[model samples]
Target chain A: MVNEQGYNVALVGATGAVGHKMLETLERKKFPIKQLTLLSSSRSAGKKINFKGEEYTVQEATPESFEGIQIALFSAGGSVSKSLAHEAVARGAVVIDNTSAFRMDENVPLVVPEVNEEDIAKHNGIIANPNCSTIQMVAALKPIQAKFGMSRVIVSTYQAVSGAGNLAIDELKDQSQAFLNGEDMEANLLPVSGDKKHYPIAFNALPQIDVFQENGYTYEEMKMINETKKIMHAPGLPVAATCVRLPFFTSHAESVYVEVADENVTVKDIQSALVNADGIILEDDPSTQTYPTPLSASGKSEVFVGRVRKDLDNAKGFHLWVVSDNLLKGAAWNSVQIAESLIKNNWL
Target chain B: MVNEQGYNVALVGATGAVGHKMLETLERKKFPIKQLTLLSSSRSAGKKINFKGEEYTVQEATPESFEGIQIALFSAGGSVSKSLAHEAVARGAVVIDNTSAFRMDENVPLVVPEVNEEDIAKHNGIIANPNCSTIQMVAALKPIQAKFGMSRVIVSTYQAVSGAGNLAIDELKDQSQAFLNGEDMEANLLPVSGDKKHYPIAFNALPQIDVFQENGYTYEEMKMINETKKIMHAPGLPVAATCVRLPFFTSHAESVYVEVADENVTVKDIQSALVNADGIILEDDPSTQTYPTPLSASGKSEVFVGRVRKDLDNAKGFHLWVVSDNLLKGAAWNSVQIAESLIKNNWL
Candidate 1:
């Protein structure tokens, strides 16, 4: 199905949440695609999806599925990426993975287009998109890092259920309705689906996001800490995160505390740095109560930064509220942007 | 109606959210109330409430209402407290004001019974109950400060709508139902009802909890910062707060970062400090996914501390997740505890 006008692209996990957003982002961005092959797990195969006024059948993804593909966007899961990303890469496709499988891989480049677009060129057949929480934090941090040298970061996240995937969104909806009705809210997919316990995410806050590591930090917290340094290329940055899942459905909001190396950086300087940044929208104005909330930034691709304030005690420290749609700039659009960069720069 | 046994008590704002909780707490704690006077604004007057199988009608509060009141508990708005608190004190009633009207007053002692119970003795006719978010944090931090010698604190709050009182809670319920039913979520009160703009708290997070100060920090954020210092009696403590309102109905959860003066403290040391602390329940065990969440901590009078971890980069720093019922330990119980302390210590 390869055509002469554009590159043939294969989208893995086309039936899932991030995958669905990827398709919409590609269609909205008018991504140059000659042949679009939708791939999913065996369970979701044969489903019909319409894109750009054309119906396409989702096929089961195997090694052979990437035969003539020029670009593959993998978001099925970490295990799927581990098994098939290399198969796709070896068969002559640049893989932009949307899982944690290759994010910390020494050879793979962890990329956020707004933070580290040039890292896309250094990929050895595969590029890794950072975690949803990490992506938005770095997008906001990069502008500040560029304007003033950064030192430390401490973030506490108010994350949405959608970052956990489609089931979590359904669970939040079901549980919320159940809670409103004075019924016992059933919990099967929250805090972590694979973890030993399940807690209600409706009208509650779960401090644990992913499974806990040996150091007592959740994998989601570690992802935010590790991937932030990797994408920003600040290996020694002292980043700490406490990831808490709130009942919201879409956008993830982080209360970030950063200490810049420059002691003279004021609130205005931080606001000015974010105002003209590529994919950042500075919505901070205390006088007007202008700031981004989950509902306000749900469908937006740009990272919204607001509530900028200098630390009362530390001259070099500043606090910011950063929010972005986890599915858009955090995952799907970032993946597609990496693909666009690959083609535009002839990195493929 | 005055009796010979126990102190004569006046309950202001008896029809409001915190006021209702205060009644329950007084009844549950078996506080020695010889006579109870229910008072509210003119709008809420004429309402009836039951206590210990007795029905009492609320009256409009005036200076005369506190004629024989030995102790007055105030949970009304700040304007009401500002107008009537002095009048109650002038009538020989020791006022325990839950509003922010006198929290920063140099003459008024800001007391968190667990942290600064002795400060209640220094009250000049009025004792200020610290903010809900501040009460839980200082309750968790006091033990750490006692054992480890605290230095700096940074907190990001996951606050509930109940902190805004009854109307805000109703807004959340109505808006959440509307959002689920695919109708428009109306917003009349949230992120400070008195503020110019109103944001929906249904399935959303609002970073502003109170009116913005000139320094760009919300009044709630400033309350956390300044009130924590006063309650902990550490005025020089470098405290910063980002107070965010979430969709939950009770229990304010805080992600706190603190640096102890002792650099060699381990996670166990921090756990040990919290394990035996008064009014604190340590619920940290990452292996079993044990942590304190808003729902788990809701309706509890004790502050729940969990997810305790040593900072990877800072030898002297630690992080904690703290949660408590905003109406109980954060408001009603704390006020009642102060009254009990006053009675026990003969401070009144």
Candidate 2:
């Protein structure tokens, strides 16, 4: 239930992709707001963004932008978040950042409320939203982790273009047109927009999601590895990831292989736990050909898992197919959910 | 490495996709053949197929087609293989069938030369080439299993349209053209051409492949499950699979999660072993964005694996991203390789 004492909320990076979705999510959830501030870089600052038929001009996010803000949602680039998120937090606003800037920080509570809602209370005016791919996986695996105590997880992701940014969505449209016309696929946006030497993703698959780290794992892969442990509160848990950028537009799908600690854990038990798991939709019926696909999960906030099965000989081994809209559960809805959790737990 | 006195050879279903590829393979490998017979169904009978500048007319495959045929390669539908394979075997002709009819017959040997070439001598007139996804995987994993002793395997596959045969390929082309013109997706072939509903795969992923089995795993999934056991000669090994059909024209990619018996194994050890393994090409240099992709692996016979890594805390577990040409390693070359193994070992 929303209170009459509404707070002033600001959306940083208001004109961007995830920011636009955040605007929609706030309205759809009927989030209480005494005032709304839309902030972006100077180039996009003056543009007017419409939310619930109410037009708000985007203002440059400076140190003073959050003076009267009680809550702030940041989906701007990591550089922008690093620059101004502290200002917003210091001005007495609870900041939920949707970038990699603060996700791995020891003090910041990296959250997917369905998995780590209580951790929200420990945040010192800032909460880190996990990576799009990591968020969906943890949300789906959390229930199973609670029931069976996950020992190890191996995931290969089929991520969408939107996770990269608005430029990537435009690149997908442009490259797709070139591919259909039998022209050369021009790629300047992904697997990393800032990284050198890009490859065509229109009719191809890229095994790299982010720039490679020194240890051989892409930053995106490390995010999944590190964030899985953070969100599930299992620091020593075994997690490995191979993140690939597919030609898909929005939703992300993962092929997850896990080994539970319990020797008696059957696939049925995992399915039952997932069916009752919060914020997760179990689509495990195989007879009618029911399973999760990225297209089906597009724009939805729920994590969809299917194709859950046990290994022929190992009673503790299992596999799952998990999918969720990266724009939703991966970003906007998750940020908004954390905001709600903060308010409910009296931490806002 | 070369032999001159090879047995007489015949190709059943010589007008089909795999059959044409088989013909190309046989010519490329220059298999020693005293006589060559091309046999097809009644509909394709009298149709001539070209191989390396030679033309051979396809005759109706009947019980009598086996006369004096020392070894026959059958890629006909399961019904045709079931109906005529026994007849051919009774005529003193050994057969290598590429249909699901005899894969699980308990008497048939499902062979991927890199994995189970020794099982060829035990074949009761027939050896089976596994499903496209399973063949490549077993080829990559066999060496690892031999060195490490695997206890569990969980795989999620990204399969191609060509696995469904030529008609589906035509349908994909037609629908892609239609979708580009802003016309309806007009699905008729994918997910399952035999199923009532169809979905567009041009910019999408379909989570179902083959018809659904009673247990909910698609026939394709079951094929991987059963064929992995047969090829790896590990019927009691734990294996689970989720088969998905992507829009690619060739090659199949799998995210394989495996648990080895040795708990202290590292990702380095796995990579070194795979580099030295037969039929496996290690393409896992993440620094330069080097990994096997379907587009890169298309038309290639080797099982290409990349994104190999050990689970964070589980010393016994590892993940591999395996890719290969479904047409080559999965079917044509494997079939031809079996024939070559036969002559080399004097098993024919």
Candidate 3:
């Protein structure tokens, strides 16, 4: 149904944080489209968004809204995607879901183009975008694993507040202002929006990124662990994660430790492997004091890898620092990239 | 020389961050002080400080300053401690140095009061206080290690800018205001004050805590690794650390992973050991969404431990979240605690 004039595209939840980024990304990449439909929940249905110098009003999404749509990009909440994504698929539109609704579904393919582009073809109707933290780590580690082979991985993340959405971002801003003015600040959303207790993230670090699971691991940490396994196709790989939320507004940085399979693998080997990999930029030079900080990698689509070093004790052990804009390569950009992959492969 | 009445005590770098904390700790602990002599470099000299409703003027420290001083606390720069610690020891004072200069000296005891207070008697003249990050971790891990016998330890730190100095604290505040006001943030003293190419730490996380060493690890990381070995008296224990500076004003939090010697060790056993250990607080209960955060643990002397769990893959492997006031248990309080132990045990 897609022609050279472009596909009939629909953007669902086009008013949320990641959804706004999706619109910008789609416009910046100049993805072809004969028609662009903006859809949202009833609350944001009347909102107007500008795309490619054209004004579009966001309409309330319904099953019939996808009558002639060829591609639908979803960034709404999980329930929205859970209730509406299959309806879009039933109408012959391919859905690229940005929520956790279908990410782990056996029939749905969890895709990170850099790590598993081939998985896109096997999707039944809905293609799942991996978690933001998981996408960045797997993208940075894919090249290393391909070159040296990884057996074990341990990661500790310094995540930003934007991953929790726009409300969390406003909380950080208002809290920071109040903190600076020596006034009391309120915390209604943060660490986990749905969790019982809320904590201030103005000048502090919260170890919990999401609601706790029965296993004592936060949902965010468990997502990083499980999604990494699925994307890497390494179910038996030993992976552990400690996810923490910092005060930054954008980008997530991680301290990753990996044990490679080969004994002769060096940091230089890993660096060289990642330097030329697609969607990864290497910024490591200890002598020059060059490594990626969250601010330095805040507004780009590439996953930055740095601080590569060999462990002193374990011969096969290596350490890496990975950084990327949580909203870009982690969410919006990755989703757009999957859409591009779908078009290039004619999967839609 | 040591009587029930009091003893002559000298406080070096009285105007600096840790030195100020040392003064406060000594005052709070009601340490017996017959005459208090405040010493600093020529730059900070002549400043007046109040102790017990009396004012004491800081004087430029010289070799003669320690002639009758019973206990000398040094927290100036490393070179200052290197230049004057032994001079104080040579005269009649027992030096409790808070700089890295003497921490690694074979004759010096790097003491964490809760971990190894008995080592105080082994000090020739100088007892070195461990680094702020190292002190908190070792204090929390000592009880667990004592009970289970640790085999390997790995730690990643969420350290505060206050650990850098008072100037870094100002920098964080100013830069934060500038960032919120949409102005440029200047970074002159961060990551490492002496290191070149400063980066903004107002709302960011810097992975390089101190200057990079020859092995690519920062001096801060190396200090944590080396100091932990010396304090734990386990030279053969495999330990690794990644030190990062966050945007907090006090307290340092660590994500520690340890492999114990005993296979039957459980999280409950680890919690029991830390709950009863002196200077350790256990705040772990995932069911209740309770865990120790940096802000919650700020200004506290005890090392707060939480998020205790056994690793999914390794039965003997356990994870702990450790937090404490970097200026208190990490430096000033630990130094004063050592002095207290010395008095109680009649070692001085």
Candidate 4:
């Protein structure tokens, strides 16, 4: 299958939300592909997905599915990635997993192309995509950390339901309809699908994103805290997060406060640094009433930064508003970008 | 009207949102009222509102409206408050203003009864009510500050549309309906009614609240910062805020980070302090998955505090989730409390 034309690529979880985005991103970017294979769990097997007007049948994932595959993208779930990622990697295929399965693995490299693309070369056939919230946040902070040097980062996220998966989006829609009709909403999946005591997300905000960990912080908060440290290679950096799920359908917005190493840094200095950063689009100008909103940033690939301001009392403290499409730059696109980097750099 | 039976009360802007709540709260609490005068702008002057099954017609407010008024509660626009508050005071009526016109005035007392009942005695006839966002935050922080002492405070607010008034509440509902129907939304009065641009707030979050100031912070954010210091009597306290408007219709929630002066203070200590404090409700129990949400905290007169946890990296820093009804505890209830304090202390 890989004789000469191009590399063989397979997409697992092809029928899910982020998986659908992966297929579309591949077709839109015209990624080099000699043969395209689609894989999913048994529940979604035999499903049909079309890319570039070509219908493809999704097959159940198995160990032998990656026999001749040169690259594989995984987005099904943590257990699927844990079981199949190693099998795909053992068969000479590079696995770019979109779950938290291998992110903290000592041998696995957690990659955000805009932040840590160079780490792609050191991956031993498996690179983990960071969390959606962490991806946008680290992308915005990369330039600031590089130019001014960062000591502390405190972020509070206004995240979307889509990050919880396609079912959560449906829940939001159903709850909104019920709310408008003055009926009690039936809640099944929200705040966390695995957690108990579900609450409605229509016209409301839930402070807990993922399940609460032992330390009172949710797992989503921990992901942002740990992934930022690992991606930036600053394990000692002080990072804290409070992740809250809002009623939006897509795009996650963050209010971030960072303390720069240099005390003389100003808001203009930070804005100018982010203006030319890759994968970052600076939209801050209070005079023109310009800033990024979740609706405006939906379906966009670039991380939009705005509301840049200096903390009134602290010379080194500054605040930023960062927004990006959760499915694109946060998951599917980041995974694809890593694969693209691997091919371009001859690292695979 | 000043006979031994009761006192005459004038409710300015009585047909408006907060004004309507003020009237309901006055009637609900069975305040001593020999006579009630409902006042509004020229447009809403002829409207009729019922208090205790008695309908009163709203009259156009003027300088002479306060001639026989023992207490005047002003919930009109800041300009109206600026133009009429002093006139009410000059006619021997103690003015309880719920607008921002006199909040920062050194001669006036910005009162949150639980935190600063003594400040009511210092009022030069006009006792200003703090901004809705500030009122809940300071009330939550008052107990913590009293026990451990606070050196710094940083807050990010998730505000409701009702804080912007009744039209903004209507905008939220209309936009949510439009969003569900797959139609375009019309936003003419949000983020700030007087701001340059309006964005759809249905299923979205806007970081800007009120108009932008010279610095990147909004006037709403500035009010929280300045008002917190004045009401706490800690002029040197370092406070910063990022105010955001969400699509919800009631109850404002805040994610607050405070640096307690005592390094050994723990989450339990703070929770215990709040459990016994006046006008504070402690709803924190991570094991039971209990915390406050906008829908859960709506229509409540007490500030709900929960999600108390210590910062993972800082021993002196703690985080809290504070929620309260924007129209009740944040505005109407606080104003009525000030009047009760004035009456109890014989300051009127």
Per-prediction TM-score of chain B? 0.98, 0.96, 0.98, 0.98
Residue lDDT tens for model 2, B160-214: 7888888877776676576567787767778987886677777678878988877
Report the C-alpha lDDT of model 2 over A1-348, residue by residue, as the tens digit. Answer: 455788899998998889989988998998887899999999998999898898899999999999989899998889999999899989999999999999989899999998988899899888999999999999888888898887878787888888988999888778777766778888787889878768777766777888998777789999999998888888888788888788768899988878798988877889889889888999877666678888788878899998887755566777788999999999999999999887777888
Model 2: per-residue Cα lDDT at residue A260: 90
- Docking quality of model 1: it rates as high
Off by over 4 Å in 3: none
Candidate 2: what is its chain A TM-score? Answer: 0.98
Model 4, which residues run further than 4 Å from truth?
A: A1-4, B1-4
Residue pairs clashing in model 1 are none
> Candidate 4's residue-wise lDDT over A1-348, tens digit each?
223477899999998989988988888877888889999999999999888888999999999999999999999999999999999999999999999998999799999988889999899999999999999999999999999999998888899999999999999999999999999998899888887799989988899988888899888999999999999999999898888899999999999999999999999899999997999999998887799999999988899999999999999999899999999999999999998898888888
TM-score, first chain, each model: 0.98, 0.98, 0.98, 0.98
- What ranking emerges by lDDT with the best candidate at the front? 1, 4, 3, 2
For each model in turn, which proportion of the native inter-chain contacts is also found? 0.92, 0.46, 0.56, 0.65
**Candidate rank order under DockQ:** 1, 4, 3, 2
Better of 1 and 4 by lDDT: 1
Deviation (Å) of A259 in candidate 1: 0.9
Native-referenced DockQ of model 2: 0.47
